[model samples]
Target: MAETIDDKIKNYRTAPFDARFPNVNQTRNCYQNYLDFHRCNKALAAKDQDVSPCEWYHRVYKSLCPISWVQKWDEQIENGSFAGKI
Candidate 1:
């Protein structure tokens, strides 16, 4: 049998293992997920598509990144100063 996106989402609990970030240090992974969430959301919204899929990135980052960092990055994004490309 095959799995669906809904199944994947429902099964998700926390950030999963990413081969790209093999080391114990997850700072890069956290930041990348944060950026991915916004970028995914933005792209879908721009296309008038459902943004639910972006929740995956949101959940991953929320589980990995610190609240303070998220807040600071959000502020920087709002002020057009965030260093990330998103």
Candidate 2:
């Protein structure tokens, strides 16, 4: 059987050490997580499915990105001005 999105969510662990972001620069990871959170929410909402799984990305970005950056993004999202791909 194929793995469902729910199964993936149920099996979620912390984000592993990404080879792409070695050393003290987790910028890519943070940005990716931010994009993923929005994408997950949009996808699940469209399908009327559980959005809980999207929380992983939320947690990751929350831990890795600056609060101000998140706040700015939130504002941009609300105002339809965010530039980054969702």
Candidate 3:
């Protein structure tokens, strides 16, 4: 296992196997990572902390989610119509 968060980030190639998302469908995994990316960024930014760690979630979601879906969700987030709380 990685010794630190930086190692985890550096080692990332695709979404790692998650016990919470064991099924074949990765839709939930993708969506959760998408939300996690935004939440991590927002929370860390508020504390004046580096937000680079959020990139892990961004990479994971980008790998698993459809581009069209990401676009739509991004648009909805901008328009305040996104259903998922970020």
Candidate 4:
């Protein structure tokens, strides 16, 4: 079965590396991810921009440094593959 939001959140929380910056330690990465996530959420929601949390999340996660998964995530989001899974 597909994973739920709770599952994703739990994974993110307990993940070995931070979602924001995957190369960094868990604590730092988690904090960074949280900040970026909130920032993206606010920007998208408040600014009425096409940018979604998924976009930022994906970019940061897949970046060469820290979190490179973000890019992979962006692809997923763009393709409607990561919907509700994040």
Candidate 5:
């Protein structure tokens, strides 16, 4: 079955954050951490030319979902966070 945007986001949220960031334990705040990780992953993927997932997430986050709470995870990474390495 084809995965929906919600499925992708939900799956991402279920995964362990540290697994993606081996050097950082960003799971302190579940919701915030997940959203940040999701946005970062999306932006990084886009930067790497892997746009499908990023575009899907962006569409959903901008339309059906609301990602206003989490600050720009992509910007945080670019500003020297561990996210830049990923």
Candidate 6:
């Protein structure tokens, strides 16, 4: 049997150190999670599939990113000004 998204979520762990975010700061990790969450949601929704897998990214970004940054990005996305790929 295949692992379900819920299973993955239940087994979620902190992300390991990534080359892209080698410094002490986790800014890149936060931003990447933000982008990943949106992309995951969009792709899953387009396929009419379960989106539970995307929750991992949401949790990461929510924990690592400032609320203001998230709010600003959301506004940018709404206004078509966000620079990152969705």
Q: Which candidate number would show the highest lDDT if scored against the true structure?
A: 1
lDDT (Cα atoms) of all candidates against the true structure: 0.95, 0.86, 0.93, 0.51, 0.49, 0.90
Q: Give candidate 3's whole-model lDDT.
A: 0.93
Candidate 5 matches the true fold with a TM-score of: 0.28
Roughly what TM-score does model 3 have, to 2 decimal places?
0.89
Residue 85 in model 2: lDDT? 83
Tell me how candidate 4 scores on lDDT: 0.51
lDDT of 4 by residue, 1-86 (tens): 89975566445532344344555345455445544664677677777776543544544433423444555555776797863333
lDDT of 2 by residue, 1-86 (tens): 79986676567565667777787888889988999999999999999999998887887788789999999999999999999987
lDDT (tens digit, per residue) of candidate 5 on 1-86: 99987687656533333354455433334344445446667687768865455444343334322355335554574576634334
Pairs that clash in candidate 2 = none
* Model 2: residue 75 alpha-carbon error in angstroms: 0.4
List ranges where model 6 is wrong by over 4 Å: 1-20
Candidate 1 vs candidate 4, TM-score winner: 1
Residue 63 of candidate 2: its Cα lDDT?
A: 78
lDDT of 1 by residue, 1-73 (tens): 7999889989989889999999999999999999999999999999999999999999899999999999999
What range of 10 consecutive residues in model 6 has the weakest lDDT sum? 8-17
**Candidate 6 positional error at 79, Å:** 0.8
Instruction: In model 6, state the lDDT of residue 31.
Output: 97
* Greater-TM-score candidate between 1 and 6: 1
TM-scores for every predicted model? 0.93, 0.77, 0.89, 0.34, 0.28, 0.80
Residue lDDT tens for model 3, 34-68: 99999999999999999998899999999999999
lDDT of 5: 0.49
Task: List where candidate 2 sits over 4 angstroms from the true fold.
Answer: 1-15
